[model samples]
Target: MIDTHTHLYSEQFNEDLAEVVERAKSQGVEKFFLPAIDSETHEKMLQLEAAYPNEMFAMMGLHPCSVQPDTWEQELALVKSYLDKRSFCAIGEIGIDLYWDKTTLDIQVQAFEQQIDWAIERDIPIVIHTRESFPETFEVLKRKKHPKLRGILHCFSGTLEDAQTAIDLGFLLGIGGVVTFKNGKIDRFLNEIPLENIVLETDSPYLAPVPHRGKRNESAYTSLVLGKLVDIYQKDFREIEEITTQNALRVFGMK
Candidate 1:
């Protein structure tokens, strides 16, 4: 299985990073896709990817919540510099987040559009992070619609209409531990959207699945998310695993 989004570089795992990865591997997780938060976390992310080159892949971008008015442009420049220097799986973890602070919405939109342009130019996917701003996110997507504008909506917890819109926009819904939550609602209409438009992710170091919810999430808990999908789709475990793994590989443009 593949954990499409996990912050294994997070300081929360500083002491037991190795054990976490091992435990995840033991659960049959073969690869982890690490999303960048900002300049501050980039090095740690890179270091983690370097430590496990074959298992961990890194993406480059500026996260919405990190878009401070003063440093956003400089941060974006730094992201561009990194992109110019090396290849990344995607340009991602980028989008608007009104949940934290609505004051920066304007700059957030600018940063989001800029990164979307970068992803299009690079002909790569862009893993989006939208929080309490799906309308705003979709607006940007609609305006910037391109043949190459494709990605996964990370931690998708939106409505059926939103899911259909994302699918219509050439994006996939990233299913994470939220589906296991009693009030996560997405599970109710998930079957309406084909499994082909879905991908599995842990969003780890956050949103751990049931029995482990409200605790530090890990890639191993991805299995729990998959188990939930099995119930939602009524498909066999191996089938859901194979399909979602393939979906993740497709998003990253991996073989």
Candidate 2:
């Protein structure tokens, strides 16, 4: 299985990073896509990818929450520099986050639009991070729509209507541990949308699945998510595994 979104470089795993990777690998999680947060994390992410070249892929972007007034442009330039040096799986973990601080809303929007343009110009996929800004995100994506534009709405927690809107815009819904939450509505939406447009993720070192909820998340728990999908679709595990894996491969251009 592939963990389409994860932060394996996060300091949260500093104490047991090796064990975490081993545990995840033992569970059949063979690939990990690491999303960049800011310049501070760039080298660490690169090192992690280098250490596990065959297993981890890195993405470049300036996270919305990481957008500071003084450093936004410089950080974006750094993203461009990284892109020029090496190809990334996606231009990602970038979007608006009004939940944390509404003050950075304007800057976040500008940064997100600029990154979207960058992705378009390069003909690469994106990994969007939208939180409490789905309408605003939709507005920006609507204005920037292109035939070649495609990506995933990472960690989607929006309504069914919103999911449909993203789908119409050529984006897939990135399903993760949130679906396993007792009250999470993701299962409801999954039942409505086609599984072909869904991809699996752990968003690890963050949203751990049930039985591990509120603890440090890791790719090893991705099976919990697969189990939830099975329950929601009432389908076989092999089918859920095959379809989601294929969806991830197609989005990330993996073989």
Clashes (backbone N, CA, C under 3 Å), per candidate, total: 0, 0
Q: List TM-scores for all candidates, in order.
A: 0.99, 0.98
Residue-level lDDT for 56 in candidate 2: 96
Please report how far candidate 1 places residue 229 from its true position, in Å: 0.6
What is the Å distance of residue 233 in model 2 from its true position? 0.5
User: How many angstroms is residue 219 displaced in model 1 relative to the true structure, after the best TM-score fit?
Assistant: 0.3
- Model 2 steric clash pairs: none
| lDDT (tens digit, per residue) of candidate 2 on 104-146 | 8999999999999989888889999999999999999999999
RMSD of 2: 0.9
Tell me which residue pairs clash in candidate 1. none
Cα-based lDDT for every prediction: 0.95, 0.92
lDDT value, candidate 1, whole model: 0.95
- The residue-by-residue lDDT of candidate 1 on 227-255, one tens digit each, is 99989889999999999898999888996
